[model samples]
Target: MKIRCVIIDDEPFARKLLLDYCSRVPQLSVLGDFSNGLDALSFLNHNQADLIFLDIKMPGISGIDLLKTLGNRPKVIFTTAFAEYAIDGFELDAIDYLLKPFDFPRFLKAVNKAFTSFPIEKPAISLNNSPQEDFLFVKDGRDLVKVKLNDILYIKGQKDYVMFITKNRKIMSLMNMRDLEQDLIQKAFVRIHQSYIINTQHIELVASDKVRLNNEYLPVSQTYRLTFREFLEKHK
Candidate 1:
C-alpha cells in the first residue's frame, strides 16, 4: 500500500532532504510541507497523511506540542538537531528519532517501520481470531530445520549473513534483510533494531536501550523506538 506522508520542519535544507528521499521511495508520496508548526496544523485539518517527519525544536509550537494537540495522529519520526531531546521524543510515542545529518540509509529504515506497525490499523479482536502459529521451516545445510518459533529469541543480520539465536542452537545462513523478513515477519517477529529481528514473545524484558531475550542483549534502533514503547504499553 502507498503511504501518503507530509514533512514538517523549519530548516529549508532539512525539508529538501526529506523531500528528495521521499521521491526515491516509490511507496511514499509527499502530500505537503510546512515550515512552521502552525501551518502544519492548518494543513492537518484537511490532509490525511499516513506518516510524518517532524522537527522537534521549531519556533512557535514545538513538535512535541503539536503532537499533543493533534486529535488524530499519523506515525511520527522525529528529526532533531540535539541528541538530548531524543529521549523525550520517544516518550511521546514517536516511531523513530533521527538525529540531524542523518543519511538516506537511516531514513529508509524509519520509513519501513510505518509499514510493519500494527497500531496503524487494527480490527476488533474476537474470540474466533485464529490462534498464533508456533513454528516455521528453515532450510539448514541439507535438510529443512523445523525451527520452533517460540524457541527463537533473535535473529542478527551481518552484511549478507543471517544468524538465528534460539534456546538450543545458533544457526547461520546466507540471506538478506528482505528474504529473512519475508520468512519470519508477522509470524511472531519484529525488527527492533537495524541489524536485529526478534520474536517479541520471547523478549524477557525491553529496557530503554536494549532488549533482553534469553541470554542476549539487542540494541533497539531509533527508528523503531515508538513501536517498542507501544509494545510495552499493551501490558499496562
Candidate 2:
C-alpha cells in the first residue's frame, strides 16, 4: 500500500531533501522528480501518481499552472518559500503547504495530513515470526537494541521520537509515527491513535474508546477508530 509519489521542484537540493524524507517512510515510493513544471506535467500526464510534492514557483510554468493543466490531478502538498501562495494553494484543495527549510517533523506532519485525506488500504496481517527477519533495531542511548516484533507490547510516539515498550524494557528511538506505522502494520501492529501503535497479539480487552494491553489502557482516537474497528471485525 505504498503511496506512489513524484517530486516537482526547481531546486536540486530541495528535491533531494524531499526524496530523502520520502525514503524514510516505507509507505512512500518515489516515482520521479523534475526540475521544471513542464517536464513534471509531461511525466504525470503519461503516468499515474498518487501524490505530488510540488514547488509553487518554477520557471516556464508555476506549480499552480501545472496543476490546472492536468485533467486528473493527484493529491498535492505545496512546498515553497513564498508565503503569499499559501492561500491559493489551499483554494485549490492542496493537502498541505510546507514552507521552505522545513524539518523532518514538519514534513512528516504534512504527510500525515495527506494520509487522512487519502488513507492507504489496511496491510495484510502477518503475526508469525522467523528467527532472522522478525526483529528490528531501535536506538537506546548509545546502543542499538534488537527488539523482537512479537515482544513489543506497544509503541508510543513522543515528540520526534517513539518509545518501544516491551515486557522487560522500554527502548526509545528517534523515529516518526508515520514511518513506524508503515513498518509494523504488516506485523500485526495497529495504530489506535496518532500517538499509539499496539501489538494485536497483546490485546487484553477492547472497549468503546480504549484497548487494554498489558494492564495499560490505550486510547483509540477518532481518527484511527474506524480502521482499528475494521481490523477487529475482520479478525473476529
Candidate 3:
C-alpha cells in the first residue's frame, strides 16, 4: 500500500518541489497540498494521511501551532528556511527537519527514514495484549531477545535503533521512538524526551527539567513536560 501524504506550505515553488519528489517515489501518494495551515487542517480532518510535509511559518497559523492542534498527528517532516525552529520541530517528534532549498538527495533521505517507521509490508513491533504476558521480544542483531516489562529502566533512541536499558543488561533493537512510545505508554512507560522514555515505576525523582531513574538522570524535554506533569498528577 502506498503511504498517503500531505504537503502544507505557503511557497508555491516549495510545494511544487515536494510534489515532484513525491511523484518519483512509488511508495508515496500525495493526498493534497495546501497554501496555508487552515486549509490543510480542514483537509486532514476528513482525510487520513500517513505523513505530512509541513512548513514552520504560514499566514494563518504557524506549523508549530498547527501541529499542536492535531490529536492523532501523522509523522511530520518540517520544511522551513529558519534554523531556529529546528529545536521546536524535534520537540514535537517530527520525523525530520528539511532546511529550505534542500535537494532531492536530502528529501530522499528523509523519506527513507519515514518508511522505516511506516513500512509498506508490515507494521512495527507491538506489545502483546494478553494480560499474563509481561515480556516482549526485541530483535537484536541476529537474535530475538525476550525482555520483561519490569526489567526495563528506560529506553534511548538512536537513529534507527532503541537501546532498552534494564536493571542488569541493555538490549538494542531496530525500532523507532514513535512506535515504541505508542506501544509502551500504556504499560507504565512515559516518553520524557525525543531520545528518552522512562519506565515510570523506576522513577526515583522528578526535577523541573529532568527525571532520575535507576541512578541516572534523563532530561524531560519541553514538549513532553506538560504530559509528564499530568501523568504525575493522575498517579499521585
Candidate 4:
C-alpha cells in the first residue's frame, strides 16, 4: 500500500521540492499540500494520512506547536533550513529530520527510514507466546540483527534513531522511540523518559525521580512517573 502523505511548509519552493520528491517514490502518494499549519491541521482532522512533511518555522502556529495539537499523529519528517531545531524535532518523536537543500538521495534515505518503521503491515505480535519466540529482528544499517527481549536492559533514543541496550551488545537502528515503544510495550518495556525506555526485568532499583538499571541511572520524567509508579505497585 502506498503511504498517503501531506506537505506543510510556508515556502513555496520547499513544498514543491517535497512534492516532486514524493512523486519519485512509488511507495508515497501525495494527499495534499498546505502553506500553513492551521490548514493542514484542519485537513488532518477529517483525513487520514500515513506521513507528513512539516516545516519547523511558520507564521501563527509552528510545526512543533501543530504537533502538540495532533490527537493521532502521523509519522512526521521535519524539513527546515535551520539546524538548531533538530533536537526539538526529535524530542517530538519525528521520524526524520531533513535539513534544507537536501538532495534526492538524502530525501530518499529519510523516506526509506520511515518506510522501514511504518510498513504496510506489521509483524504478528507473538513474542510473549513462548520463551523461544521472545525476540525481534531490527535493521542495523544494512543488516537485520536478532535481539532477544530477555537480554535487553534498556532502549535509548538518540535523535531519530534508537539503540537497543542489551547485556552483551548495543544495537543501533534507524527508528523512532515511539515506534519502538509500540513494538516492545507487550514485552514488559516502559518509557521512563522521552529519551529512555527500560526493560522492567532489568531494573535494579526505583528512585523518586529516576530508575537504576545495573550501574546506570535513568530519569523518570513527570510525564510517565505516575504510570511507572502504578506499574511498580501492580507488579509488587
Predicted model with the maximum TM-score: 2
TM-score of 2: 0.64
What digit string (tens of lDDT, one per residue) describes model 1 on residues 1-236?
46788899999999999998787665577899889999998898788887899998999999989988888888899998999988888998889999999987677667656655643311100011235746655534323466667787888898745787888798865445665665555565777777988888888787888888876788999988887677666645
For lDDT, the strongest prediction is 3
192 Cα displacement, candidate 1 (Å): 22
Task: For residues 123-149, write the lDDT of model 2, one tens digit per residue.
Answer: 111222575669776645434577889
User: Which pairs in model 4 have colliding backbones?
Assistant: none
TM-score for predicted model 4 compared with the true structure: 0.52
Residue range with the least summed lDDT across 10 consecutive positions in model 2: 120-129
Clashes of each: 0, 0, 0, 0
> For candidate 1, which ten residues in a row score worst on lDDT?
120-129
Kindly list the per-residue Cα lDDT of model 4 for residues 105-190, writing each as its tens digit.
Answer: 67866886788777453321113446656887775654557778889999999886678898789998656677678777777888
TM-score pick, better of 1 and 2: 2
Q: lDDT of each prediction vs. the true structure?
A: 0.76, 0.85, 0.86, 0.84
TM-score of each: 0.55, 0.64, 0.52, 0.52
- Model 1 misplaced stretches (Cα beyond 4 Å): 118-236
Q: Compared with the true structure, what per-residue lDDT tens digits does model 3 show for residues 1-236?
A: 78899999999999999999888665689999999999999888899999999999899899999999987899999999999999999999999999998987578668768877864532224356678877777755435577889889999998866899998998876577887887787898889899998899999999999999888899999999999999888877
